[model samples]
Target: MYVAVKGGERAIDNAHAWLAEERRGDLAVPELTTAQIREQMTLAVNRVMAEGSLYDPDLAALAIKQARGDLIEAIFLIRAYRTTLPRFGSSLPVDTGAMACDRRISATFKDLPGGQVLGPTFDYTHRLLDFMLAADGDVPAAPEMPVDPAPVPHVMSFLNSEGLIAQETCDGTPAPDLTRAPLELPAARALRLQALTRGDEGFVLGMAYSTQRGYARNHAFVGELRIGTVPVEMEIPELGISIEIGEITLTECETVNQFTGSKTEPAQFTRGYGLVFGQTERKAISMALVDRALRWEELGEDDQGAPAQDAEFVLYHCDNIQATGFLEHIKLPHYVDFQSELELVRKLRRDATGQGAE
Candidate 1:
C-alpha cells in the first residue's frame, strides 16, 4: 500500500542528506581541493566565471566543488553569490591595445606588428591520447620568452587607415545592463555582447555553426585573436584619481565580415567582435560569428530568419541556468495532474465503446 506523505520538509531534508553523501563518493579516496580544481581544471573554472559573470576564481572553484563538478550548477552558484555582493564603483574600461599579450594572431594579414605570436595554442597539437597523463603525468617545463612590453596596434586599424573597412563610433553612451533590467527587443551591441559572453558555450557554438552552414553565412575572417592580461583601473571619488586595482586575463576576437554598400556609403568591410574573461578562444570566435549574424538588421542585410540572427530566440534560450531549472522541475511531483489525465482517458474510452455498441 502506498501511503501519501503530508509535509515535504522531512522528505526534502532526507533527499538533500542523501545527495550530499553521494557527492562525496568514496571515504577512502582523498578529497579534491578547490585549489586543485582552480589550477588543474582551469578551463572548467573559466567557463564558470564567464557564464556566472563573475571574475573571482576562488569562489568559482568553490562553486565547482560544491556542485560536484557540474559546470551549469557551478555557474548558478557563482551567479547567486554575485547577487549578494554590494556595488562599490564601476571600473574604467581597460584598453586592449595596451595589453601584455601572451598570444596574438591575425588570419587576414601575414605580417603584423606583433609578428604573429602563437603562445600556448592547441592548434598544431596531435589528438593522440597520452598514457602518461592518465597516471600522474610528470610534464616538462615549456621554453619561456620574455613578454614584450610594447603596445601592439589592432589589425583593424590598419584596414581603417586604408579606408577599406567601416569605422565604429562611440560617443560615450553608457551601455544597458542586462542583469539589472529586463531584456528589451532590438538590443544594442553592448547588451548583445554581454549576453553572448555569459551565454551557454554549447548553445553559442551551435548558433555559430548554423551561420557557417549557409544559414546567414557571413564570410568571417579572423582579423585578430588575442589572449593576455590588462590592467583594471577604478576612479577614486574622494581623491579624484584613477588607480590600477588589478590585472585580469582576457580573450578578444575581431572578425572581418563582408559588406554591402548603400547609396550613401561606399563598399567597406564590417566587423564582428567578442571579448570574454579568461583564455577562451573558441567561445570568443564563435561569439564573433553570432554577433555578426545578429547585426544583419543594422548593417542593412536582409533578414534570413536564421537561429543566430534571431536575437530574442538566442538570448532567451542561451541561459543554461533558466533552461536547466525549467527542465529539472519536470521531475518534481505531478501526481494530481497525472491522475486527472488518467481519469479523462478512461472516461473517453468508455464513451467510445458505448457509442460503438449503439
Candidate 2:
C-alpha cells in the first residue's frame, strides 16, 4: 500500500517564510543594501545582467539580493521581470569603433595603434584573499593614466586588408530573434551567437576547453579583447536625426582561427566573434571559441564528432534554468509511478515462485 501526504500548501507557505528569514541572516548584523551589492559584487551583477539579457545594474543587484546570491535564480527573476516591460523602438547598431575603451588588448600583435591597455584586469592579481576586505577599511583610489583619445582600429580589419583572413560579408537582412520564434534546425550564425552569449558561463567554458583539448581543434588566437563603454543611439523619425540614448559597458572578443581552405576556396585565416553585456571577458572569449567550433559546417571542415561541434547538444543543454527545473522536479510526487513498478515486480516474483495469488 502507498501512503499519500497532504497539507502541501501550508508546508510550502511555512517553507517560504523560513527562507525569507534565512535570506536576511542574523538580526544583529547590518542588512546589505542593493547599492553595496551593485558596487562591491559588480561581477555578479554583470553576470546576471548578461545572462538575463537586461542591462539595469540596480535591478540586477536587487535580484541578486532576493535570490540570496544564486546567480541563475537572479537571472531568472530578471528575465521574468523583463517580460512585463513595455517595448520601445529599437536603437541603431552601436558603433564600437567609437567606443571609449578602458581595456584594450591584442594577443596577435606585439604593438599596435593605441598600444596595449591592461585596464582593471584580475589576471595579474594573486589568488590569496585580502583579510582587510573582511573588516571596514578606508580604500584609496589608484592613480589614473592618460588614455589614447584616438579610435583604436580592430586587429581583424588589418588582416582583412591584407587579404589574409575571411571577409565579413553583409547581406543587410534583419536577424531572427530567438525569443520571439521557436528555435529551428540549422540555426543562423546570429542566432547561435545570441544563444552562446546568454548560455551558462561554466557550460560554455567547458565546451571551449574541450575544443582546445584536441576535440575539433581550431588553433584559435585571441585577435583582440576589448572592454569599454559604448554610446547607444536611436534615430528619431520625427526629428530625422540620431541622438545618443545612453551608454553601456560591453566586452568584445574576436578569435583568429587557422583555416585550411577546401578545394573550392583558398587557404586563409577565419574569424569568430563574441560581444556580451558588461565586463565579462572570460564568458566572451569562451563564447567565441565555441562559436567557431560550431561553424565547422559553414567553414567546410569535417566534424570530429566532438561535444562542442554538436550544435543541438550545446544549445539544448546550455540553459541553466531549464536544466535546474528538470533536475529539481524529481522531488515532486511520484508515488503512483513507483507503486506501478513495485506491483509489476511483485507479480513477476510471485509468478516465478508458482504463487498465482494476488
Candidate 3:
C-alpha cells in the first residue's frame, strides 16, 4: 500500500461538508418542516425517543431530519445533546400498572379484566408503500373524540394470585443511572432493562432471536404487551403529595418462560421482562426474551453456556452507541501503536530472510 497520508483535518472537513449538503437535498425544495416530520415520521421519532431515553418528539424529529433519515445516527445525536442539558430532579418512577393505556393486549388470557385495545399498530397493515405519502397528502383527520382516563389492569395479576410465576418484589431502591455512571457487573433486573431499552433495536432483536433458535431455548410466551402514555409523578416532600409532572409513552412487554421446579416446589413459570420509551413493541418484546434468558441462574436452570444466558455477553453487546463509539474510535488515530507493530513485522521478516540465506 502507498505510505499512509495524514491529512485528517482536511478529510474530516470535506466529509462534513458532503454530509451537510446531503442532509439538505436540493436548495430549491422547501426544507422539511419539523411539524411535517414529527407527525408523518412518527415511527422514526419514536425510535429516537426510545433509544435516546428522552421523550421530546419535536427534538427527535429535528434530529432525524438533520441526520438525513439515519435513525441510529439521529439517536446518537439526540443522546449527545441529551447529555449536555442540565438535570433538575428525577420524577418518582411512574406506576406503569396504573397507566392510562392507549393499547393493551394479553396473550396469556383471551378475556382480561380490561378488554384488550389494539390501538395504532402496523401488525395487520399490508407491506406495500403508500403512494399518497410521497405526494403532499391529506388523510381525513381522526374524529374529535373524548376519552375517559381509564386505568389499565395488568395481565399478570391473575398469575400472581396463583403463585405460578416468580414473584416480583421491589424494596423501593432507586435504580442507578448508566449515563452518569459506568456499568458494573452483576447488574440488577432494573439496570439490565434500562440498558436494553435504550439499546440498539436490531442488536437486541437478534440476541432475542438467538434464544428461540435453540441457542438458549427458554420456551417463552408473550404474557402481555402494552403501549400508552403513562403519567410521571413526583412526591414533593416539601408539598407532601404526589403531583403529575409529565407523561411519556412506554412499551412494556412481559414474557412467561418455562421453569424447572426446585426440590421443595413443583414446576412453575418464570418471567422475562422488557420496557422501553415510546410505542416500541418490537424492542420491548425483544428485551423481554433476552431478559428471561439472562435469568437462567436465578430460575434454577443450568447455565448451558449459551450467548443469551451470559449476562456479560448480552448487556455489553446490546448498546449500539457504545459498540459504535468503540468500533469507530479506531478510525480516529492510532499511528503510534500502528508504527510500532509495523516495525516489529519488518524486523521479524528481515531476520527470517537473513537466517534462511545463511
Cα lDDT tens digits, model 2, 200-236, are 9999999999999989886799999999999999999
Q: Any idea what lDDT model 1 has?
A: 0.90
Collision count for each candidate, in order = 0, 0, 0
Q: Point out the higher-scoring one by TM-score: 2 or 3.
A: 2
- Per-residue alpha-carbon lDDT of model 3 for 1-358, expressed as tens digits? 1235578679879999998998889999999999999998887899999888888999999999998998888899999999999997778867888787878887878987778777888878999999897895888787765565778678877888898987878989988898788888899888888888888999989989999999897778888899888889887889888888888888899888887788976788888888888888999999999988888776668888989888888888888888888898877657778888999998889898895355
Candidate 1 scores a C-alpha RMSD against the true structure in Å of 2.6
TM-score for predicted model 3 compared with the true structure:
0.91
Off by over 4 Å in 2: 1-5, 356-358
**What lDDT score is found at residue 349 in candidate 3?**
94
lDDT: worst 10-residue window of model 1? 1-10
Q: Which candidate is the best by TM-score?
A: 2
Write model 1 residue lDDT over 21-44, tens digit each, in one string. 988889898998999999988888
Candidate 1's displacement at residue 307, Å, is: 1.1
- Model 1 stretches with alpha carbons more than 4 Å out: 1-7, 355-358
- Model 2 gets an lDDT of 0.90
